[model samples]
Target chain A: MSLIESTATELLGQLQSGRTTAVEIAAACLKQIDRHDAKIKAFLRVDRDGALARAAEIDARRKAGKPVGRLGGLPVAVKDLLCTKGQRTTCGSRMLENFRPPYDATVIAKLRAADAVLIGRTNMDEFAMGGSNENSAFGLTHNPWDLTRIPGGSSGGAAASLAASMVPLSVGSDTGGSVRQPAGFCGVLGMKPTYGRVSRYGLVAFASSLDQIGPLGRSAEDIALLLEVIAGGDPLDSTSVDRPVPKYTESIARPLENLRIGLVREHFGEGLDAEVEAAVREATRVYQSLGATVSELSMPHGKYAVATYYIIAPCEASSNLARYDGAHYGHRTDEKAMAVELAAQRKALQQTGDSRKLEALDNPLIRMYRRTRAEGFGAEVKRRIMIGTYALSAGYYDAYYLKALKVRRLIRQDYDRAFEQVDLIAGPVAPTPAFEIGEKVDDPLAMYLLDLYTASANLAGIAGMSIPCGLSTGGLPIGLQLQAPPFEEERLLRAAHMFQQATDWHTRRPELS
Target chain B: MSISREEVEKVSLLGRLLLGPGELEKMTSQMGQILDYMHLLSEVDTENVEPMAHALDLTNVLRDDTPGVSLPRDEALAAAPHRDDECFLVPAVLGDP
Candidate 1:
């Protein structure tokens, strides 16, 4: 197999044995990206020179018999949402298109410390808003399995890069299933570590409470390896919990005997595609045969996850996005032109004796803010911002935002109750396999529903993962989700690792041109 | 609840976005549809349930009030679209200014 196609663990083995150099692996990955990225559109920026230099440094260290970090020489792709010092971290929006961070995000710093080669920044939904890669301001990332279909998002490019063998491992932020859903669509393993398990110091805020940085890779072990390096507390992020880091890589091989898996009663209901349901059900049966027990567990409030998420996520988004007003950084409107236009409008209204209209047009600063945001944000982003503003508006706060938060508590409570009866919950990651590129672009509700199975984990502050289960009738890949209680990523990884050992599903790659 | 064009425009202004006529119309209907779907939450009785702001029950996490290294002034202003040596440039806040 090509170096680009090898799993991170396999590549690490090759590097350790002196069979392959870091430079060779970096060159191979860059070559793969060069040859196929045009059709895949997975990357927003590829750091060719930087990656090669990093790899050469690793090779030199090894040649000099110096100690290198655990992930030395591994080429990894990062979602553009994570800030990398001196690298353009666009968050897949025109607002930050030319913006580069002054310093690395805590996770990026960890990756660098681990001696990993940061290969490139990947495409994502604008501000990590949409479930489909089509929401990306740059362009949609096509699924490597079926080029006409989306690779799932807002971590679409992260997953696509892995699926297309452009990178052995990639890091992505999961806010309402950004990482896992895309990983599901791309037929790879993705994890959303327990909220606050990984630092969010430089992750551009979407929904702060729901966001968590995680790993995407070809195998469960690879996911665990990356998670081990990046998962920890950072003083920089106040939300990052101060706890001892677990040896995730060391715990992956532990047997999962007597594991109690909860098959969430609501997940297999009306909206779930039959193939996805079957695949997940079969995955449960596999767990059962491995001396594990499966039981039907009811999370009564599970049905309300999507509804509650829509309100809470957008409400938080509005507050988080308020910073982009053409003042501090990002896209700025033509302030001089805006001022002149506002003056003209005020003068026109003054002549017409429309005092009300003139009063509204009086503030040139407000006008500049509006025009800048309108020009900077795309249609969906605008819609979300407006929805959020309305939800949190004076008259509607109790009815919308507060109500959703209460419902969010109920959702979290339901998961806590379900975990009492089971060690982990397994179900379909998304309603169906990968859908076509433009399938749900016009329908925001349909796109939001794509997050139905995944968002509750974020809401509950628990760890969740997606592993390749089976293929749809149309030959698209399906993913089975595994969720665990907060800070129980080791258990989640153990169960997934056990599953992968028994099934060859994760080993199945898309037939790419 | 049906979101009127007036409401959409109002919310857009609050969000600091200037939607065009077409965008205003589309957003009005889309917001109405989303709000209509959100009405499902009302069916559940949450009479005394405490609203959850954070998933983890964390109090205000404070470190010792100690000064540490901060971002260099030049690097911090590097990405600003409109900036001078010391501060970010913006349109006049007051009409007379």
Candidate 2:
């Protein structure tokens, strides 16, 4: 196999055995990115010089007989949301287009400690606000499978980079299906580790409670290998749970004996495409053939997932995004223009003898905040913020935000009850394979529906993953989603590993030009 | 089942997004439809259910009161849109300056 097409584990094995150098691997990945990244648009920034320099350092360490880290110079693409010290972390929004983070996110630090090279920053929806990467202020990421379709998002670029053979591994954040849906669309493996499994210390915040940095790669083992390095507690993120992260790669081959997998009845009913439904059902049979018990599990609150997520995610997003007011960092309005406009408003209000109105009009700071955000954020972002503000506002708070939280509890309870009967719940990752670009961009409701199957996991703060299961007739990839209860990543990865062992769907790569 | 333009205008003010006429017209209808769809949550009776603010039930993570390093001032101001060497620059908070 070409070096570019090799998974992270395979490349690591070769590197450890001295069969290939880290510079060769980094160069191969960079060459492929240069060849096809224009068409794929998977990356917003590709650090060719930086990646090679770091790889050379790793190679020198190996040559000198010094210890190498776990990743050992493997090139990994990072979603633009993760803060890399002295590097631009735009979060796919114009609001932070020129923002350079001064500190590495905890995961970046962890990856660096493990000797992994962060080769590039992948594209995402602005602040992870949309299901499709079309919300990205930069540009849409085209699927490697078919250039016309979207590679689902807000982790679209991360998944696409792997699918397009630009990198063997990538990392992204999942808040309401960002990681899993894109991995499904791009026909790879992605995991949203149990909420707080990974620290969110320097991850650009969207929905503070729901967001978790996830790993995406070509196989379950690759996801597991990366997940082990990035997962754990950090004092920096207070919300991160203090728990022991299992050595997932060490025990991934051990399949659950007499495993019980649940298929939600609602997932197969409506909206789910016939092809995706067939694929997941076939996967269920594969588990059954492997001597596992398969049963129909009813997560009764499944239907309410999208609604609950829409309310809760947007509310949290509005609160989290409020920090980008142009005061400290990020995009700010020109002060000269603001002064010009403020003087006019002040004079107009003074002529009307309205001191109270003049007090508001004369405040250039408030006007700057308004104009800065209005111009900085994109349409979908603004729409979400407006909706969130409306929901969290005085009279509607109880009706919208509060009601969503109660339903969120109900969703979690559904998972808690389902886990009582089964070890894992299986379903189709998305309603369908990737839709064509511009298909749902203008239709906000349709775009939100793309999160239908995936968002509930975020709401419940459980572990969820997507692995390639089948291919559509049109050559698109379909994904089977497996969800596990909180902090059960070991089981989740093992369960997904079993499917990988049984099938070759993940082995298939897209015909990238 | 409808969100009025006036209501959306109020929301824009609250969100700090100064929407123009065209965006306002479009957002009004879009927000209305989204809210209309969100009304689906009302069907499930939750009068007795408790609100879940976070997924994990972890409490506050506190450490010893020790002074440690924070982001250096120069590094903190490095990305600021408008800044002096020492502090970030902003428009006058109260009135013209």
Candidate 3:
């Protein structure tokens, strides 16, 4: 039987049956990347040698009858944001263009322990800032389905890599909709575990409270396999949940009878493309046929999700990214040498009684800090950082940041109430199918609104998954989202699997040629 | 309210991003649009709203002060762009003696 393009589970089964070797799988994937990446541009860096070496080691152990880890021999692509020991981990920014971490992130360590082959680092929006991969300083990662279109982002490269068969599974971080939106755009399975469900220790901080590392793959089962390996607690990440790891793979075969599905009315409201709505509605019918009852629920403040996320995420991001000055790691400038030049400018304004300039010397450290940040971060990242900085600034803290936090609590309460009445919340993952690359790039607010449907989960700190439900009229994939209460990832997986069992959407692949 | 190009430049400087002249103009326009959209938040009556931070209701799950493994000085600095004698070398801070 041909096994070159199977999912992670299918490949694992073949490995168990002695029909394939990890080296063979790794070589085939590397060959696919070599041929497809020129067109798709999914990977930022491909660790060909490292992948083969790891795959060979896995094969060697299997030959010696050694016990293997869960995802042993699976080729996995990692978003560049995660640290990989001795590997260039540029979070798609020129600032840390050549910075390599001396250690692996806790998730990477877990994947390594599971014997997964580290295939490569995929591109992302610089510092995971923009909604579209166009913000990547390296280059835009194209949608595998339609080369001229964007592969959703900031996990665009990760999603594109999987869509192109460059790798069967990849890791992505979702803060706001980084993972899910991209997965929806690329027509693949992407999941963001509960806020602390997966360790965020090695993920280069974007929005600390919102950032979550999760898997992207061709199918829900593949995501389950990867999540099983990556989920759990770690001392390195204080927020990581210290709960018993759920048997996600085992849940894949569970029955879906009497499941309660909540259709969030706010997500289906205006701005959602008719085609995307149809696709989700079709998936809902399939779930209903599987004996899951669907009901309409309301998250009235849902429209405020993106607005609230912009304030909270950027505020947290501004604080978290403060460590990246040239003094610590990544890019730095000779601010001290440039100080004389800066002071002159500051003094010129001071003499004019320009309160703006007069306030400058009050804190030269602020000047240096602002200069380093201004020079290092990207436009979108900077805008959010500034918004966050202003919100948390001495005068505006109680009004903006603090208020956003309170509204965020209300948003979380909204989700908590909905879950009590439903087994899972289901909706369209994005408002529309993948749009053209530059369609929303010029309009930042237009782009931010794209995460309206996906950002609520981050606000509520709940587990969410996006599965390919169907194709839009334009022939792009539409993602159907499913979410569950905290630590209920297994139920979320079971419900998604049930829907998958009734439809062939997950089995479809984008035209790569 | 229109956010001027000058304001965008000020914010950019505060955030540490070096934008080219063209990028600055683009960002100014984009940030102005985003800010306009964000103005809607002011309409929401959040006078008594409690801001949310951590997702779970779980309070600070702090561990007792305990000794933990520390990275070796050399190992930690192995990835430093420039290092010397157990210290990371950076551009000298001019004001510091």
Candidate 4:
């Protein structure tokens, strides 16, 4: 197999045995990206020169008998949302089109320290808002499995890159089901570690309370390896827990015995595609046959997760995004141009004899702010900001934002109750597999429903992962989701690894040109 | 739960965003539909449940009170669209402050 097709674990063994050099691996990945990324649109920017330079440095260090870091020479793609010093971190929005951070995000620093070569910045939903990558300002990322379909988003680019064999590993942030849903659609492994398990200091905030950075890779062990490097506490992010990082790679080989997996009844009811449900059920049967028990369970409040997330995520987003006001950083409106336009509008109103219209062009400062934001953000982003602003406004906060928070609590309570009976929850990652690229673009609510099965894990701040189960009749991949209580990522990875070992789903790759 | 053009305008103003004439109508209806869907949360009985601000029950995560290095001025100002030396430039805040 070519270097790009090998898993990170296999590449590591070859690197240690001196059978392959870091430069060769980097070149292979770069070659694949150069050859295929045009059609996949998986990356916003590819750092060819930087990646090659870093790989050569690692190769030289190895030759000089210097200790190499874990993940040495491996090419990793990063979601554009993460801040990388001196590199353009657009967050998939025009607001930060040319913006470059002066400091590295905690996770980026960790990856660099581990000797991983940063290959490129992947595309994402603008500011990580939309359920599909169609919201990206750059362009939508097409699924490598089928160019006509969308690789579920906002981490669609990361997952697509993995499916296309452009990179061995990638990092993405999950706000709702961004990482896992896309991973499922693209037929790979994606994990969202517990909220505080991974630092969020440099991840462009979408919904601060629900967002967590995680890894996407071809295999469960690959995901675990990336997670081990990125997970841990940092003084920069106070919300990051101070717990010791577990050896996720070591735990993946442990036997799966006497495991109690809960099959959520609500997830299976109406709206779930028949093929996806069948694949998930078959996965459960496989687990049962492997000396594990599967029981029917219910989280009654699971139905409200989408509603709660819509309210809370937007409310937080309105506040988090308020920082881009054309002053400090990001796109700024031209004051002279605005003045000219306002003067022209006032003159036109004067000619039309409309005093009210003339009087409305009063506050130039406010006009500048509004015009800048209007021109900077996209349609979905504006809708969200407006929704959040209205939800948090006076006389409406208690009715909307507060009510959503209360319902969020009830959702968590539902999970708390269910966890008392089961060790982990298993179900469909999304309602369906990959859909046509433009299928749900016009209907926002229809797109939101696609996240029905996955958003609850984010709302409850638990660990969750999506592993390939089977393919639909249309030849698209389906994913089986495994969710665990907060901070139990090791268990989540182990369960997924055990399932993967017994089945060949995770081993299958899409036939990409 | 039905949002009107006037309400959308008000909310957009609050969000510091200007909507085009056609966008106003679209946003009003879209926001209405989303709000109608979000109305499902009101159906759930959350009267006694406390509001959850965050998933993990964290409170006042404070760090040591010490001076630390901050981003250098040049690098910090590198991304600014409009900036003067040592400060970001903006439209006049007050007419004659």
Candidate 5:
């Protein structure tokens, strides 16, 4: 086993025992990153000096016999979407490439309070838009399992870094399967905490309602530990749940016997790969052997998840992204040119005997706004923004945006009904395993389909997890998904932990080193 | 499901994104194909259903309308790409007077 395979709990135990110093373990991870990051390209930027200094301080505290928190001294990889004070928290977008925040996100603050070493920011899809890390303006983050294949995304780099053994635990955001899908492809545990279970104050927005911060790690236990520190209400984020936070790590140790597991029939339909279905079936058998009852559950509304998500996510995205229009916080261009070039041209056109009254040509502010946005965002980002703008536009809001909202309601209702008959839902995280780097890039629809099984959780605001169940025939990893109703993350974790105990797939590490 | 290059250009304009003629053609085709796949949502019955915006059952969680701490003017303006004395300056958005 590689040093990266060391679970967060085991590493914490070693730290408390004085068998391993924080500096030693952190240096080891940094060395591994230096040795292997070139081929993997998992990191957007590594805070070598900051990380080392922090580790040294923690080591000093340990030597002084100072009390440390549960995850003290362990390194954690953070996806680029989470804001880190004084660090360039670029959300894989050129628009904010140099943007740094004055305050730390609530999750980052909690991790620091727990003494978890902040290692670095991982790469991701620009603005968390694509299914593959290929959308990142910095570079693509390769899957450690197969360098040529994608690591899934927009949390692709976080999953890759963990799978490559650069870090034991990493944090990622899931707007639509960003964490879980990549976690599956990288052969790790990725959890999308129930919406509002974790604070979103520091996370850069994608789809406001759909966006969530999650943990990606080697196993359910590591995620459980991270979630404990990160979960709870924060005054900084109004959306954070004020409900009581459960003892996640303790709950994960609970046995899974006589628990009802549902297999969503729609998820295993025609498009699913034979290998993926087989792996999910095998996982179901394991659950059955653990004294759990597995039953096939019908979720006919699940067939519309992709469609519903596309409309709803974009509509939210268009509004959330409106804050970046060459104003208050982000990139802005030259003013003189804006007045002389764009403004004068419009003025001249308006002065002329134009028949259409230069309605579109009348407003130079609008023109400048258009040019700035056009220059700033990528293709996929632009497409979604336009679709959203159109959906919410004057004439079509009732037909497109409002109708999508109603459908989203039906979709959630379907899950609520399903949960009535079963304690949790189980299926393959994705329809297939990881595809090639550029396989679905040209086909946006095909890329969106990758979230077929995962987006429903985001839509319904329930907890979902992806754990490595088996490997595909093509040598890529497949994740078996287990979902629970709101605030039932403990149950979801328990079921996943039981399945993990019966298999060795979670222990398998990609040979990136 | 079918989007043309002209439609792509129009959409790009609406989105405030500049796309070259070539990119417009490519994106139109790509988005069309993607939209075709997304039409599956229409297959479900959504009649008389109330739209769900958020997952949590709680509502009206907005902060009270009292004044709160605000960032210093200079500190907020410090990160702007371009700035002037006492304010974040951008190209005159209203155009020349």
Candidate 6:
């Protein structure tokens, strides 16, 4: 295999065997990003010189027989939202186009300490507010399978890069399927650990309660390898659990015998593409053939999972995103340009002789906050903020935000009930395969429905993953989702690994000419 | 359960964002549709259920109250759009004092 196409596990063997060097691996990844990224638009920025320098240091350390880190010489791509000191972390938004973080995110620091090469920042939706990369203030990323279709987002670029073999391993965050859905769309392995399984110290918060950083790679072993390095608690993120992270890499090889899998009845009916449902059901038959019991289970509350997520996610987002007001960091409204508009507004207000208008609209600082955000955020962001603000607003709070939270509890209860009967729950990751770009761009509700099967995992805070199961007749990829009880990623990975061992679906790569 | 245009304006104000002239109409309808879809929550009976704010049961994570090395001031202020030597700059908070 070409250097870029080698899995992280394979690359580690090659590095340990002294058959290849870190500089060569980093150069090969950089070359692919340079060669293919113009058409894919998967990366916002490429750190060519910095990555080579770091790779050289790793190669030198190995030559000197110094102790090398676990991920000693691998090249990994990071989603743009994670802060990397001195590197521009755009979050696929113009607001942070020039903004550089002063400190690295916990995950980035972990990657560096593990001796991995930081290839570059991948593109994502602005603040991760959209289901599609179309919401990116930067350009949208095309699916590597078909140039006309979306790769999926707000981690579109991250998944596309993996599918195209631009990078063997990449990291992304999921708040309602940002990672898993795109992984499914691009035919790679993507997983969202139970909430709090991974630290959120430098992940740009989308929905604090729902967001969790995850890994994307081409194989189960690669996923398990990357997960162990970035998983584990940190003092920096208080929400991160202080629990033991099992060596997922070692456990994935030992397949769980007699695993009980539940097929969510709601996921099989309505809106699920026939091809995807057939593929997922076929994956179930594979599990049955492997000495596992497959049974139909009903999650009555599952129908409302997407609605619950839309409310809770946006409400949390409205509160979390309040920091970007053009004050301390990020984009600020141009003072000189705003001065002209403020003068015109003041004149109009004075002419109106209205105290309410004067009191509410005349503040220069308030206008700056309003204009800065209006210009900085994209359409989906504005819509979510508007909905979130309205939901959390007075009198309506009980009707929207509070109600959604209560439904969220019921969704969790449903998962807990299912776990009593089964070790894992299996379903379709997304409703369908990657649709043509702009197909659902105009319909926000249509886009929200894309998370129908995936959002429940986030809402319930369970470990969930998407692994390639089959291919659509149209040549797109279909993903089978397997979710486990909270913090049960070991079980989740083992099940995915076992299924992958039986099917060649995970090996199918998109032809990215 | 459609939110009115006036309500969307009020909500936008609460979010500290100002929609441009044409944007208001488009967003109002878009938000209205989303709200309508979100109304599906009303179908479920959550009368006895408790609201789950977070998935995990976490208490306040307190640490020792001691001074620790912090990011250098210049580095902390490096990305600020408007800043002085010591503090970030913003428009006057009080109006026409």
* Number of the top lDDT candidate: 2
TM-score of 1: 0.98
lDDT of 2 by residue, A173-223 (tens): 999999999999999999999999999999999999999999999988899
Task: Give candidates' CA RMSD values in order.
Answer: 1.1, 1.6, 2.9, 1.5, 2.3, 1.3
Q: Residue A316 of model 4: what lDDT?
A: 93
The per-residue C-alpha lDDT of model 3 at residue A123 equals: 91
B1-97: candidate 6 lDDT, tens digit per residue: 3877788888888999998769989988888888888888888988889999999998899889999999999988888888899999898886472
TM-score of each: 0.98, 0.97, 0.93, 0.98, 0.95, 0.98
lDDT of 3 at A482: 88
- Model 1 spans > 4 angstroms off: B95-97
- Candidate 2 docking quality: incorrect, acceptable, medium or high: high
Cα lDDT tens digits, model 6, A109-143, are: 99989988888888888898776798899888999
- List ranges where model 2 is wrong by over 4 Å: A343-362, B95-97
**Interface RMSD values for the candidates, listed in order?**
1.2, 1.2, 3.4, 1.6, 2.3, 1.2
- Alpha carbon deviation, residue A337, candidate 4 (Å): 1.5
Residue-wise lDDT of candidate 4 within A1-513, one digit each (tens)?
Answer: 879889999999899899999999999999988899899999999999999999999999998999999898899999999998888999999999988888899999999999999999999999998767999999989999899999889999999999999999999989999999999999999999999999999999999999999999999899999999999988888888989999999988997678999998888898889999999999999999888988998899999999988999999999999999898788988889998987788779899999876766647778888999999999999989999999999889998999988988988988999999999999999998899988988788888888888888898899999999999999899999999999999999899888888998987777877
Higher TM-score: candidate 1 or 2? 1
Which is better, 1 or 5, measured by DockQ?
A: 1
Docking class of 1: high
Off by over 4 Å in 5: A334-359, A362-364, B1-13, B36-38, B62-68, B95-97
- Interface root-mean-square deviation of model 5 in angstroms is 2.3
Native-referenced TM-scores of chain A, all candidate models: 0.99, 0.97, 0.95, 0.98, 0.96, 0.98
Candidates 3 and 5 compared: the better one by DockQ is 5
Residue lDDT tens for model 5, A259-354: 999998888888999999999999999989889898987887787788888888998998888888676666664556656765566667777957
Give the CA lDDT, 0 to 100, for residue A170 in model 4: 97
Native interface contact recovery, model 3: 0.53
